[model samples]
Target: MNIASKIFNSHSKEDGDFFLAMTRILGFKPRKLGVYKKAFLHRSVNKRDKKGNPLNYERLEFLGDAMLGTIISKHLYTEVPAGDEGYLTKMRSKIVSRKHLNELGKDLNLIEHVESKIPKAHFGDNIHGNVFEALIGAIYLDRGYTYCEKFIHDRVIVPYVDIEQLEGKVISYKSLVIEWCQKQKYSFEYEVYEDTGNDPVKHFGVKLYINGKVMAKARATSKKKAEEKASKRAFYALQDRISKN
Candidate 1:
């Protein structure tokens, strides 16, 4: 029997909805509803299995991450015969970047099915990516590697993994800025300060300084994001110098 046939034989409306949703996303039936359920379960629910193992998607997320990396690696190895280890690694990073995964989840509307105690609006951007990874893990566990591979190939690889475009994609602007500064032997610093936004959400401001010169400034909901934003601005400011090196 398929996932819905064996696992979702009940008359619960929620189960029916979940079955249909999984079918739409996976382009096939899911074997174990409970397995996929745990994929979306938040730790805040405080549930546990018969063996007393914690019930949450974290472990599944780890497995999915590994699967994504392994499958992407194989594709890169075959497609880019000229790529060295470092080049292939970088390309894979670009394809599976957090931002890209978050986009994928958003495209699939995965967050709508998340069962969490916290309000959906309160969740961070990474929640989308986390569930996406967890879904991959659930697929692996439900039907094994072949189905897992097919799901990734259809949902992730075919639609988004473009080597030619990815070559120019910069996953992290902050990393690029730091690399450029290091290569050119220029000292740089990201000076952070309290953000003055009146919004309820916390914010941070950062100023990117290169050789005692203020290159760019930006503000965001988190320090890392603020720094990255500042670095992006700094990159454009020094694009010519950075690109040549």
Candidate 2:
């Protein structure tokens, strides 16, 4: 398409606002708006292409995840020459951790542009991060690696990443607690059970047992959350012991 045609197409009523929004978020005019739109296309919409294949952001999310990892790995490789493979991998995990990605997505308000049959309020916390990965995948497909790297550097690395702070940041308190327990040779268990108490949603309750004694208890909508919550409480309660050893 000619320049004028491209401009006219982008300004069409159906996608004009979306086009402008993409330009602002991407920091450049997108060559294919469809790819960008696919990033926000939730699977609940049940869209399909001519080939009868499901069309959603899931594929793009996978691609974006790989792309994000590659770019972040390269950055870490260059910046931290002394870090070994394990250290670098852990640092990268900390940077692209789901919690961090969710924060980034929320900051960008990426959910506002989602095309979904489901209500936004019904979406889980990870939805923001999932779409964020989808957006990165779309960027890679539309503009290739260079553009993808630039976007990550601009939005994630330069703005949010701090090497020193990230070094001390705990990605998973549960992991820390488990590692500590294993190293100290203490018997540990997470006893989880259904705990729906007056709440409409069924909850899971977990008790963190160390040395066969209940160290902490917590409840959440999911078993994993409850376990993590209980582990966090256990960590704080036994911080001095854990830290000293």
Candidate 3:
């Protein structure tokens, strides 16, 4: 059977019902249901389109990232007239951060619809944000910018956006720790080393030191994550001093 036939055979009216429910949640009806299906298709499936291009959400996720940033930036610009460029950018970053997007994706239970060869449990937290971005890409391709904007407003802005709360939000503990150290004129270092463990995934360990004293140590699958974990511990350890200075 051809791709069209296979798609039609695999998806029934019940599937459409489920998609319609998703559309209601997204506030937009997708014109090409196949696009949305592709949006949920994971890279592990190893599927390809007619042109021999990989059919997964990664490319769509990139598009959605830009779209989301644009919409959020516009909202921040209009909402805060007195705010400067840096302030608006930072606020937008906090709102559309990967962590926040992942949470939003999980809150919507998007993983239930994911089509992947890999076990769902094995997927990392970023999968949620990836699906969310793919959803935006599908909406943009199906209905265009107006519908896309509406969907973002309904699903993203109206429900979750709070200027005051976002202002206080921290996008990265690592950045915070670095800033605090710089402000206090204290020398700090993150000594990253390979972790020897039996885990399938290679892990990186980080020892965060401040002013020649060991502050915290952490390990994670990635160096950035390990550093962030260490920085978080360091932050709490020096929270009193940080607040004072």
| TM-scores of all candidate predictions against the true structure | 0.66, 0.66, 0.63
1-245, model 2: which lDDT tens digit per residue?
85435666757755777776777777777888899989999999999999999999999999999999999999999999999999999999999999999977876778999999999999999998999999999999999999999999988897567686588776667898999899989999999999978653457899999999999999865687688778878988898765788
User: Which candidate leads in TM-score?
Assistant: 2
Query: Per-residue lDDT of 143-179 in model 3, one digit per residue for the tens?
Result: 8888889878976887468675477666678898999
Model 2 is weakest, by summed lDDT over 10 consecutive residues, at 2-11
lDDT measured at residue 234 in model 3 versus the true structure, 0 to 100: 91
By descending TM-score, how would the candidates be arranged? Answer: 2, 1, 3
Give the winner by lDDT: 2
> Model 1: per-residue lDDT, tens digit, 1-245?
65455444755767878887877777887778788888888887888999999999999999999998899899999999999999999989988999999977776778888888888999999988999999999999999999988989987887567575588666778998999899989999999998856533356899999999999999865687688778878988797765788
Better structure of 1 and 2 per lDDT: 2
Which candidate model has the greater TM-score, 1 or 2?
A: 2
User: Which scores higher on TM-score, 1 or 3?
Assistant: 1
Residue 177 accuracy (lDDT) in model 2: 90
For each candidate in the order shown, give its overall lDDT on alpha carbons. Answer: 0.84, 0.87, 0.82
The residue ranges of model 1 lying beyond 4 angstroms of the native Cα positions read 1-11, 169-245
